[model samples]
Target: MSFVPIICGKRDWDVEYAQSQEYNAIYCPNCHNYKVRPVKRREFITIWFIPVMPFFWGKQLVCPICNWRQDFKSDEQLKKVLREQDNIRAGKVGG
Candidate 1:
């Protein structure tokens, strides 16, 4: 039998936040639109293009249209945006 070399590398996966709005009121400086949403970026070790182990992770408010991103320093900061989004959805705040 011939031995095959294993390919291991890091990969990033962008995951949408569960409570995020479909189209938030936050404006994207790059896209000039209100198409921002909370997103989680997960970095993983991949073998043959399949994720195996997690390496690193981060959170951001991103625009899917133009790929504009704003990184979050802490969960509280991220939650603040999410709360604003909820207020907008509930008509408590102007969108």
Candidate 2:
């Protein structure tokens, strides 16, 4: 009889991301590119590389070049960030 050992453990962050069109014109401060993309993030638990349960989820603005993530709990919050950033870009506020 031969037995093969299988590694089994829970892994975090099974994220699902989708870019939003609302902030497509926004530029990333770190990379100096107009690539500030809004993404939906979902964290899940995995067993043997299979997602079995979801633990956390949220929306964020991600800079692809810098890999910076800014989290928001609601649509209103995201809109607030967009407005704030736009103001900064317009020289109406100090970033």
Candidate 3:
């Protein structure tokens, strides 16, 4: 498989062009069930802090279909998603 490029600091190329893959998501927002997502050009850019010492930052995606929605980060989104289930442990952010 080809490598999916991930960057930090600044990117030279336009983000739109760099994203070779189309990320698709259909949310039954009413039912709270989201459809399987397509392969996204993923990256981890950080800007916040909230304990756990090692859990911040995430997947950044430009939604293909719902281009209307805000571009969401994978890390922040996942944190909000899996706030509970304490027993599990993981390395710090950027690990």
Candidate 4:
């Protein structure tokens, strides 16, 4: 699949990221239910000089047939956006 990056957190942008992927079930201890736990998948990548370049991609699984979900952004997409932004800022291309 083609990757695309998007911002997620509001005030949590003061950190760095690494290229990676993750998968697991989201178990809720408060509910004490197994099915209440859904699956989760994600990816992330970091850039050297920009906090805005941190890309995160993922999707939370609820049900297969239901199509209820939360999707995340990929690192490649983030890198691309940052690169494009940098290029534009540098006057390397047209607006």
**Model number with the top TM-score:** 2
State the local distance difference test value for candidate 1. 0.77
Look at candidate 3 and tell me the lDDT of residue 78.
34
RMSD to truth, every model: 5.8, 3.4, 17.5, 21.9
Native-structure RMSD, model 3: 17.5
What is the per-residue lDDT of model 4 for residues 1-95, given as tens digits with 9 covering 90 to 100? 89776544422221223423222223223443323213344333433433443344443334334344443356465445446645765789875
Residue 48, candidate 1: Cα error in Å is 0.8
lDDT per residue for candidate 2 within 1-95, as digits (tens), equals 99986655565442434445676766677788887777777776776678778776777778878887677788788788788877887899753
- Per-residue lDDT for 81 in model 4? 44
How do these models rank on lDDT, best leading?
A: 1, 2, 4, 3
Question: Would you list the C-alpha lDDT of every candidate in the order shown?
Answer: 0.77, 0.71, 0.33, 0.40
For residue 44, give model 2's deviation from the true position in Å: 1.7
* Per-residue C-alpha lDDT of model 1 across residues 19-70, encoded as one tens digit per residue: 6344356766687877787778888999999999997788888888998888
Task: Sort all candidates by TM-score, best to worst.
Answer: 2, 1, 4, 3
What does the lDDT come to for candidate 3? 0.33
Q: Give the Å shift of residue 70 in candidate 1.
A: 2.1
> Model 4 TM-score?
0.25
